[model samples]
Target chain A: MNILAQLPVIPIILPLVTAPLAMLMPSEKMGGRAPFVFATFVVWAVFAACAGLLHSVATTGPISYHLGDWAPPIGIEYRIDLANALVLTLVSGIAALVFPFSYESIRSEIDRRQISYFYAALLICMTGLLGVTITGDAFNVFVFLEISSLSTYALVAMGADKDRRALTASFNYLVMGTIGATFFVIGLGLLYQATGTLNMADLKIQLAGDKNRMVEAGFAFIVVGMGLKAAMFPMHLWMPNAYAYAPSAVSAFIAATSTKVAVYVIIRFIYTVIGADFSFAPAAFAWLIAPLAIAGMFFASGVAIFQDDVKRMLAYSSVGQIGYMLFGVSFGTEPGLAASLVHLFNHGLMKGALFMAAACVMLRVGSHNCSAYAGLARRMPFTAGAFIVSGLSLIGVPLTVGFISKWQLLAAAFDSGRAWAGFLIVASSFLAVIYVGRVIELMVLKPAPADAPEIKEAPLSMLVPMLILVAANVYFGLHTELTVDLSERAAHALMGAGR
Target chain B: MDILNFFAERYNYWIFITLMMMGLYIVISRGNLIKKLIGLNVFQTSVFIYYISIGKIAGGTAPIYVAGDMESRAHGGGHGAENGGGHSAPGADGADALPGKDALGAGALHADDMPHGDFELAGNDLATLTGNAQGAHAPALHAAPDAGAPIAGAPDSSGANDILAAPALKIEEHAIAAADAVKEVAHQAGDVVYSNPLPHVLILTAIVVGIATTAVGLALVVRIREAYGTIEEDELESADNVAEFGAARAQEAVA
Candidate 1:
């Protein structure tokens, strides 16, 4: 047995082990920062493992690791094709970058006694996401999804130290997330009954030419369930408060990775398992995903512009950004799917940077409200600069990662002869410009209060991660080989698997 | 057939659907967090029942195997060579046999054949045969020849007789003998056909996942109540609204 072939499961195992270890760390008067140190090291190891797995997959094609040497169709398999490899890299890489930043981000927000538990929950959440991306079994997806979601609820509730509203936000999210997971399992049950198999590859083979009502019902359930998790359109009611009220580190990590993983699952279910030939009818695409995608773009952006809280504004903007991804998927073409994949990676970078910047500002100002941001540039120049760059990226300004994805998205929109969608995409970016510009205007243009206290920039631990992610947005924006190549391969693999 | 008859045959499905609707309704319509969690349990349990029903094969026993070819196993030393020579390709020979047939004990059964009603008869016959073999070795085993002796009456009987009687009538021993006989037949027939253990295993996993979700959910609810002092959805929503309005006014004052 080549041990290198087993590298796919290490990303999951590293964090799974790290979480409980972090929990076991004594937080009061004993282990000052041991939990943070342990968690950061493990997250970095997960990132390395994911990077190695992605490289192996890109070179050797898909890697199949039978857990305990059990073969597929009988045993659980962890299959990593290009699509999941890209997501695994994105999720673990973001977790690695965010954990270092979280030490400083949580120091003020969470109590000293609860800090270790917070780190424990964060690592478990990371493990859940990695597990979801790596597992090839349908039921395994549900299991991992709950693993991540349950921990995320706990992590969100930790924000109660800073704001009690975080409690309700976490509760609402728990309820909705549970419902979404149950629906997904119900769909998995239907498919298992119909196909006598739970493995995605086996389902693909068994479900070929079998388009009964039960299969169609399963398709509906899976899409709706994943859509709720992805926060697609009307199902996104729980997101704004949860993101706004959660601790800034949890916000940055979850905003950057969780929904992206859900979208990846939706794409996998539709293109890989259901087969785009059956599920991707023009009428269905136009009638279902098209309206929801467009509605989420405009409605969310519209709601965002009116928000006073900076974090909540960004949360609504996150919903609008998800719209662009779903819009790309609605085209049901290679370019469209590729554009969605590109945005999935690119938006993760941009939003991670933005939320980290927000965390830095919150460190100084004690609030994430727009009014608290007046003349912030004079006090925290480095963080203000990071936010400006990422904010511009959110607006799709040229030479930023957002521009790259939006350009691809628009090109695909027009390539598919959806001129109206192209126009709408451009229009939504302008809405992004307004919301982003509002922040820049408040931070740079407004004058400070007369009795304003002198506040230094965020600590170096936080600054380093924020700058690194901001640098990635600019670097990948200019040299798009790695992201574009990976996304294109993943998109082609997905489309080729369909039908 | 009328609709009632159709539903009667699939009463489990009808019950699943009804329980699913009730659970979904409770989850959506209830305001209390704990009630909603109970609703979630009801919903998830319905799915479990649905999956278990999918794995339920009519007239099928538990997925565990019972001996199907006692004659071949009893005379296995000769039968293996005879069948291996006769069916050069074992898979094809197994596929050719009739499913659910009682030709198993005569050494004519194949691996693909679904064990049916005759499987129990075959097990009893093997149990008796094994019993007789033991009786031959130890004539003292014939102390209590009552095959179905009441266990309550055993205490009044001779101690040795009670031991012999209980062992002969033990269900587990019968099952073990049957399984042994089935394994021997499986070796002769080239494979074992089972009642789709995969779904049962997968659903067992799903049920565990469901319980984990419920535990986490209830934990969150407990925490939410501790912090907010209320776990009712309406109360929580109103509190959130009040907080939102206060923040808005504060922002306006700063402006």
Candidate 2:
């Protein structure tokens, strides 16, 4: 096979191989800053590989690489269509930025000895997420999902150095995540029993338009399971604490990528393997998941307005953001799915930037609460500046990436004759404004308390990546070729491929 | 009749439901961290049983057919395989067949001439089938070398008989006979109908994941113990509530 043929598995394998080596770089006799450099190199390589994969998928349509030439329908296949290619690029692209940002950002947040190990864990987590996105095998998705979830539990608990609350948060997540994963496995087993195949493409062919009870039960199981992982409302209990307690760099990376990938899996299972034609699926999406999406938007954003802790507030806001993505899914039309995919990409850019800004604040002020942020705009000007730009994006202000998502989502809603849902989206934007406005008011309008800690602007390491993401928010907002057009194409590909 | 068959033949589903619910009940009802993990293990084990049982065919043998077994059974007029006598697919068909048994007898794999491996063991497994059948098996039992036997009791394996009770071993011959008696059934002269191997293979991968989950869960509990000094969920709750809000608010929240 040529090098390009082997490109799909590299994003998964390269980081998995290099992460351990990076972790081992800090031995007592041979210690240096090499581990950080190596980990950064590894993430960027993965990012480049994903870019190549995306290019290949765009040019050639979908690329399916069977593991070791084992052939599809029997062996595991790494399917790189437009849909997963977009998600792969988003995840690795976030990891690429977050790695260098974390070098300086996590210094005050975690123990010194745990730094290299933390980077390694981050690499493994990235690999797992990438693996989940690329595989066409249903059970392989579970395998990679667990790989990521297991590491995430450890990464979130690493916050225990800062607060014991992180421990409880991690344990709570472990219990819930395990139950969620097992539910997913049960669903997979049922699918395997019905079709006698684990490959997603094969399952689609075998399950073509047959709305039997076994498939229906499996569909329900798969949704609820992935719902918990994607931080779908009511099942999103693990998310806020996990994000709030994690190291700031980790909070940024995970917020930007992990739940987004879970959202991708939900889309994959529903539209691809299960197909929208299933008797129960469209009805369920309209009745169960869509209403939950509307409820989460109101409930979480309203709750975000009351939170004293900025990190927890942002985490709640993330739940509300996911509601927008799922709301797009509820429409069940091509434009609707396209709108969902667009938000998935745009949300990654915006949320990732927002969290990195919070990280810069955490680096200096050493507090997660909004009170710590009182009128530091003059002192940490760049940090507050980046925060304002990203915060505006979060509020769906014009000429930022957030507007693109809300515009398309609203358009899709109205196009599908769900004009009330469009109104709900607008109303939710107001809730985002209230919550985001509270923080903006703190950073901009309010005066600094006289006793504010004598703080400087964020370090170059943090500011550089945070600014790059913020710039991308403006860049892609102006240029819809990448986010809007590509996502719609991805949507068309997914819809065509599914049926 | 269909309903009765549905209930009776599908006892595995009933047992799966029972074990699954029991594990879930334990996880939900327990407050102790370790007990919750134990419940999770039970829950995971039920899934494992469900998957592995799904691989079982009611009348089929294990999916473990040796390439060597097929080769030996190929040389019908010959003594045993050049690779040494291995247990076979059906039995050696002609001159090497069993005494007083039909040369075409399906499961009666006469191993009187075998030099190595589990042909004797395969026959002795049928000792439970009929007491009178196996004095002929006595000399072969001692000669059944453990070396080169890939699967020790493999030849006796019906996928159903493997996980089933010891008494199901006796039904292997009858199952094979009853299977052959049906007109719709088809087989080669030597091919053993194997249960689907894919589910078992899938379960093996799943078991690895289950172990990892258990290990990670326990490790998280260890960290939790170090942090909170307790693994009880309620105690950790009160401790977290106190840590989050002030003592007064934590008390009110608890109430």
Q: Name the top TM-score candidate.
A: 2
Clash total of candidate 2: 0
Error of model 1, residue A62, in angstroms: 1.6
- Predicted candidate 2 versus true structure: per-residue lDDT over B1-255, tens digit per residue: 999998988888888889989998999999999999889988888988988787665444444332222223343324223223332212344323534433423333333322111111123212211211211222111112223322223333243233222211222233344432211111121223345566677788888988988998899899889888999998899888887777998899879
In lDDT terms, how accurate is model 2?
A: 0.78
Query: After aligning candidate 1 to the native by TM-score, how far in Å is the CA of A323 from where it should be?
Result: 1.1
Clashing pairs in 2: none
Of the native A-B interface contacts, what share survives in model 1?
0.43
- What TM value does chain A in model 2 reach? 0.98
Model 1, position B91: C-alpha lDDT score:
23
> Model 1 over residues A242-276: C-alpha lDDT tens digits?
99999999999999999999999999988888888
Error of 1 at A361 (Å): 1.2
* Residue ranges of candidate 2 with Cα displaced over 4 Å: A27-32, B1-5, B66-191
Best by DockQ: 2
Top candidate on lDDT is 1
